[model samples]
Target: MKKISIILSAFVLLSSFTVLNTVWTNDDPHSQLGFTVTHLGVADVPGTFNDFDAKVTSSKPDFSDGVFELTAKVGSIDTRVEARDNHLKSADFFDAAKYPELNFKSTSLKKAGKNKYKLTGNLSLHGVTRPVTLNLEYRGSVENPMSKKQTAGFKVTGTIKRSDFNLGSGFPEPMISDEVRIEADGEFVK
Candidate 1:
């Protein structure tokens, strides 16, 4: 009888945890995952990944305990300039044929301000994984009339040095900046 009571208690605890968390899938068509980098120290060249997936699960709307994961196909890079995009996919940069995807998984989310959060995560690019922190802004959540589903919006911004990932080697600062700025505007549905 004691064993049965213990088992029931354990099950209840686990079930409560599951009930508290909400899982949300990103709405791809409405999302934008893009980056910008300096070109020849003159102008900024903007680009985006055409294919990617992101999901977030949290116990609260603020996402203080959120678990976020994102995967982007390196080969789907688009800069609007075919030649430049192809070059970016070659050995000079992402080397999409060798390392097909760039990934990120959040380790922690800390509230910073009214709607801002600091998200720490592991970013894997070019076969190397490094710790990165992104500034996340929660835009708010709404109920969709069409599907009657709950949806949330967020914007994320971060920077990464290409050299840390062993990408775009030998490009001097005068030719290309090592720093890349990443941005994401995403909407997720529950």
Candidate 2:
């Protein structure tokens, strides 16, 4: 009976470890989430969020059944222009004071082509949530020499209309285009 009990305990411990292996966290410093918008009908202005985090869970190494959840601080937006950045954080734009974070959670992922996938998810920004689809390209994985852990990289790109989220509403397209291009270079560690 004691031997049987020990075997059961070992099985439980192994099961827990297997479950833990499925979850991965963002290596925030090495990861980036950014966006671009047409400025004055000519050049595109790019910006990045300085603070963000994400968690990914997958039962397979290929991430065919992966789930992702991400949150980014609205106040961390940077476009290399302080005045414009400040304005973006104001009531006219993201309203960082009221809505502090932007969030996304994956609903589905389907193969689009080799090493590419169509990821559909719910994106919440400025108190509004909507479905968004991103083209995700798996950048492959590597073993970190220092940490001796596996790290995976992905590039995600998508376009969303600011008007869809009730953000920066009523702004003429030529002044501030309705479309925003989203890009993320995400690194996840297991």
Question: Whose lDDT is greatest here?
Answer: 1
Model 2 CA deviation exceeding 4 Å by range: 2-21
Candidate 1 per-residue C-alpha lDDT over 45-152 given as tens digits, one digit per residue, 9 for 90 to 100: 999999999999988767778899999999999999999999999999899999999999999888899999999999999999999999999999999787798889
Q: Write the per-residue lDDT of candidate 2 for residues 97-118, one digit (tens) a residue.
A: 9999999999999998888899
Single out the weakest 10-residue window by summed lDDT for candidate 2: 15-24
Candidate 2 similarity to native, TM-score: 0.90
Candidate 2 global lDDT: 0.91
CA lDDT scores, all candidates in order: 0.92, 0.91
Instruction: Supply candidate 2's per-residue lDDT for 21.
Output: 39
TM-score of every model versus the real structure = 0.90, 0.90
Question: What value of lDDT does candidate 1 attain over all alpha carbons?
Answer: 0.92
